[model samples]
Target: MFLSTFFVVFLLGVGQAQPEDRSKGLPTSFPVPHTDDMLFYLQRSRNENTVIYDLNRKADGTVDAGNPINVYYIRFARDGKPWPLKWIERKFAYGYSHKKLKNQSGFQIELVAYDERKIELIPS
Candidate 1:
């Protein structure tokens, strides 16, 4: 009876040890060639930069899926103009169907860059 109870407890402990997330292979977004921002995105949700990383069993625990997208590296063309949020939208078709876009682009992404952490998309 004692051994059976111990085995059950051990199994439960193993399952509980599992983390809530797994890391995906998506690379962190790099700058657009001029700026210093970092970016990473989810291909499944082309327009959405809220890339989620699922729990992945990697050799090192440092890397994982679903890291937040960084947008410091890319630069705007005009001096004052910024990389439009629409750029990510149109690039990934944020509002449009992803399946259609995927067929053409095969899940590529355009990284965005900004100094402030807040996404410019939301209206002030």
Candidate 2:
């Protein structure tokens, strides 16, 4: 009886899944099956000891091209400055499809920065 109860409890514990984390300030993954005017992705970047700390996608000419987005990339020049780049947005280059963003493709967005240090991505 005790063994059976333990097995049941174990199964229940496994059933209860953990929530996804995305608090590292990393950009979210881009959408696949990219439909019209879909949110590609959002992320942060670094530069050679300097961080660009600014972004402006609409101004970056990355505005939805209707399909096959360029997925423009961006870096930083802020050695010890804030992020978000000079404008409001940056481009994406590559990545995996997110479960939350299933069917969405990964855009290649490079972050130009002088910091040299690499950053990781966290889904939000």
Candidate 3:
């Protein structure tokens, strides 16, 4: 009876164990890139690398109609530099398709990897 009770207690303790926090003890000086055209950036708990979304502009200082958002990676793990997505990443991961909204109010952007959630980009 004592052995069975101990086994049950051990199993309960193991089940109640909490997962380690990966963000804990990480470096505080993670690099952040800033640019004039950058709209925003995203970071994940998986790594220090960041995804940047910027305004795609034409030579005449106007936003590109067909592709208004330029997406790329700021690889902090490598050299903390900006890098374009590879072909596979573009087609399967982070690449997005956008369409102009009616009356030119904004755009409806859909991510290639996750098409269920729609993002609206309205120019100010």
Candidate 4:
């Protein structure tokens, strides 16, 4: 009788020690247009100037299946015009979704210089 009781107590203790589900408290929806902001970590390669990272939702702020669309970052020059390049040579920033304009699915991000910012992207 003592052995059986101890075994049951041990099992209960083990169960309690296990970690809780990490996604239980996460948000289900992405940032909304003109009403929300989502930060992202940006990186660049030799061929591409910008790549999106640490985003949980799709560009349209909808649940993504597996493959999400890639949106490149654009920088405007001092002449009040966008840079003309086939691909950005080198660029990196930490930006957040600022607004969702007409015809845009995801929020348009406003990027600044890189920093040690950490963003937790919800997993699909």
Best by TM-score: 3
Q: Which candidate model has the greater TM-score, 2 or 4?
A: 4
> Which ranges of candidate 1 are over 4 A from the true structure?
1-32, 37-67, 71-76, 87-124
lDDT of 3 by residue, 50-96 (tens): 88889898999788989989999998977888899889987998888
Question: What lDDT tens digits, residue by residue, belong to model 4 across residues 5-99?
Answer: 99999999998896867566444443222213223323332222333333445767773434222333433112222233333322333333234
How many clashing residue pairs appear in each of the predictions shown? 26, 53, 0, 1
**Runs in model 3 lying further than 4 Å from the true structure:** 1-29
Model 4 Cα displacement at 14 (Å)?
Answer: 64
Give the clash total for candidate 2.
53
lDDT of 1 at 95: 24
Runs in model 2 lying further than 4 Å from the true structure: 27-124
Q: What's the CA RMSD of model 2 in angstroms?
A: 16.1
TM-score versus the correct structure, for each prediction:
0.18, 0.19, 0.69, 0.22
In model 3, residue pairs whose N, Cα or C atoms come closer than 3 Å (at least 3 residues apart or on different chains), thus clashing, are none
Against the unseen true structure, what C-alpha lDDT does each candidate score?
0.34, 0.35, 0.86, 0.40
How well is each residue in 25-53 modelled by candidate 2, as lDDT tens digits?
54344212322333443443321222222
TM-score for candidate 1, residues paired by index = 0.18
Candidate 4 residue 2 C-alpha distance from true site, Å? 83
